[model samples]
Target: MGMPSHLGLDDFPDDVADEFPSDVKLALFRRARAGAALRLYRRRGWNDHAVRFQYDRAAAELAIALDRWEHRETNPTLF
Candidate 1:
């Protein structure tokens, strides 16, 4: 499926959708899109070191967001 401009909570798995707030979901979606954009930029030969670093950071942030959401969903104490 193609990337969406905005990700709704409904886009998440039912468990996740029920657990995460809208802001967290939006952040996860934005970071994912940013990372994807950076990847495309690098692929197009726009491989400046700064761009690469930003891409890496974005990717890391996206992973962290997902992890955080998962943790919140799985652990009642975290929610």
Candidate 2:
């Protein structure tokens, strides 16, 4: 599936994109899209808040991936 034009790969910071693998980058983008969707749903007063859970989970996953990339970048010998 293609990302929305506003959320395309070019939107990512160069440093972050260069450090992350393709899969990780895609995951981050997906998480961002989920967060945006969650915001829209909340703004429109949709009753179901279950999407917030999904958005939270995606945020957590993205955070973990970013942490791993940062750690690896700083500790090259450990890998």
Candidate 3:
């Protein structure tokens, strides 16, 4: 079996999670911020459309970074 559809930084293989690519770092930062925002939104009882949109955007960014990283690892010559 391969990695799951969703993965946290710790779920990544090896030290790649620690010394990640710049894009991964950015995505992780955004994901963390979005997560924090979600918590704040919930605390304020603002479970609206915007909150969902932010969540989706953050998830997409992280997924993209992971895909890119996986591709780079598999086909190093192409990168």
Candidate 4:
């Protein structure tokens, strides 16, 4: 899928959100927040160290979100 021109913390379809547990939703929220921060730092030409920190944080958050999403079905009681 093509990337959106803009990003927001609450980007998913509202109806779909009800299907997942709170932990999964929270993971996605964190991932989106980190991604937005990373994008902003890069666009504003922030210091390399700051940008890299956001980059790493965003990557970690994304991994966490993906893992939660994938495992949610098998472990519905996960937090």
Q: Which candidate achieves the best lDDT against the true structure? A: 3
lDDT of 2 by residue, 41-66 (tens): 98898964788888878777776666
- TM-scores for candidates 1 onward, in order: 0.49, 0.65, 0.75, 0.53
Ranking by lDDT: 3, 2, 1, 4
lDDT of prediction 3: 0.75
Looking at candidate 3, the ten consecutive residues that score lowest on lDDT are: 1-10
Expressed as tens digits, the lDDT of each residue in 18-74 for candidate 3 is 667788888878887887888898888986568768977998988988899889888
Residue 26 alpha-carbon offset, candidate 3, angstroms? 0.4
Which residue runs of candidate 1 sit more than 4 Å off their true CA positions?
1-44
Give a tens-digit lDDT track for model 1, residues 1-79: 2222233344545565445566556666666667677778878888657766765666566566666756666787843
Return the TM-score for candidate 1, rounded to 2 decimals.
0.49
Q: How far is candidate 4 from the true structure (C-alpha RMSD, Å)?
A: 6.2
Q: Looking at candidate 2, what is the lDDT of residue 43? A: 88
Cα lDDT tens digits for candidate 4, 14-74: 5766665576566557656666777787798885576567656755665665566666555
lDDT of each: 0.59, 0.67, 0.75, 0.59
Where model 2 places Cα greater than 4 Å from the true spot, the runs are 1-19
On the 0 to 100 scale, the lDDT of residue 23 in model 4 is 61
Better of 2 and 3 by TM-score: 3
Which of the predicted structures, 3 or 4, would earn the higher TM-score when compared with the native? 3
**Cα displacement (Å) at residue 58, model 1:** 0.5
